[model samples]
Target: NYNVLEQVYDVTKFLEDHPGGDEVLLSATGKDATDDFEDVGHSSTARAMMDEFYVGDIDTATIPANVKYTPPKQPHYNQDKTPEFIIKLLQFLVPLIILAVAVGVRFYTKSPSA
Candidate 1:
C-alpha cells in the first residue's frame, strides 16, 4: 500500500501498467510517496486515474512528525535562448555596426582641413 497525501492507495494492479515501471511503484510502498508523485508532475488524467485505487485515509496521529507534504517546485522553461547561429551572427554584427557608426560620426564631425 502506497501512502500519498495522507490517503492510502493500493497500486498493485497499476504496477505493470505504470509508465515508470513496477519497480518505481514497489519502491514507494510502506511510505508516504507524495513527494515522488508530485516530483513526476503527473497530469490531471493521471491524478484522476488514482481515484480507482483509493483505499482509505491514514490517521494523522499515526503519521510520523518528520513526514510532511511539500509540493514540488515548478520547472522553469526557458524559451528565450536564441539559436546558436543567430547569437554568433549578432555577436559579429553588433561590433561591426558600432564601429561603422563610430567611423561615420568621426567622418561627419571632422573639421575641414584648409
Candidate 2:
C-alpha cells in the first residue's frame, strides 16, 4: 500500500529481502516513500529491483482523505518592467545627481569675497 512517485508498490513481500532491514520498509507502509527511498541512495541494482514490486499507478481519485496534493506554483515576472539592477542604480544615483547639481548651482551663484 506504499506510494512512491505516484506508483503503488507492495513491499510487504519484499520486506525480508530489504538490505536495510524489514523494520525500515515496514515503517513506511501505507505512505509515500519517495523521499525516504531517494535519501537512502539505493544502488542501480536496487532501483531495478523496484519494478518487480510495483503493483500499478496510484488512482488519484481514490487517494486517502488525509493526503493533500499541492499544485506547483506559477512563476511571476514583469516582462515590461525595467531590470532590477538598472532600477536599483537609478534609485541610488538619481538623488545624488540632483543634490550635486543643486550644490554646483549654489557655489556658482555665490558672490566673490572682498
What is the C-alpha lDDT profile of model 2 across 1-114, one tens digit per residue? 654347889988888888899999988888788899999999999999899998988765565579677998988866547598688888999999999999999999999999
Instruction: Mark the regions of model 1 whose C-alpha exceeds 4 Å error after superposition.
Output: 1-5, 63-114
Q: How many residue-pair clashes does candidate 2 contain?
A: 0
Query: Which pairs of residues clash in candidate 2, taking residues 3 or more apart in a chain or in different chains?
Result: none
**Residue-wise C-alpha lDDT for candidate 1, range 1-108, written one tens digit per residue:** 454448899999999899999999999998889999999999999999999999999776666768678999987855456487678888999999999999999999
RMSD of 1: 14.1
Q: After superposition, how far is residue 75 of candidate 1 from its true place, in Å?
A: 58
RMSD of each: 14.1, 12.7
- On the 0 to 100 scale, the lDDT of residue 80 in model 2 is 49
Write down the lDDT of every candidate, Cα atoms only.
0.89, 0.86
Model 2 scores a TM of 0.50
Candidate 2 global CA lDDT score = 0.86
With candidate 1 superimposed using the best TM-score fit, by how many Å does residue 21's alpha carbon deviate from the native?
0.1
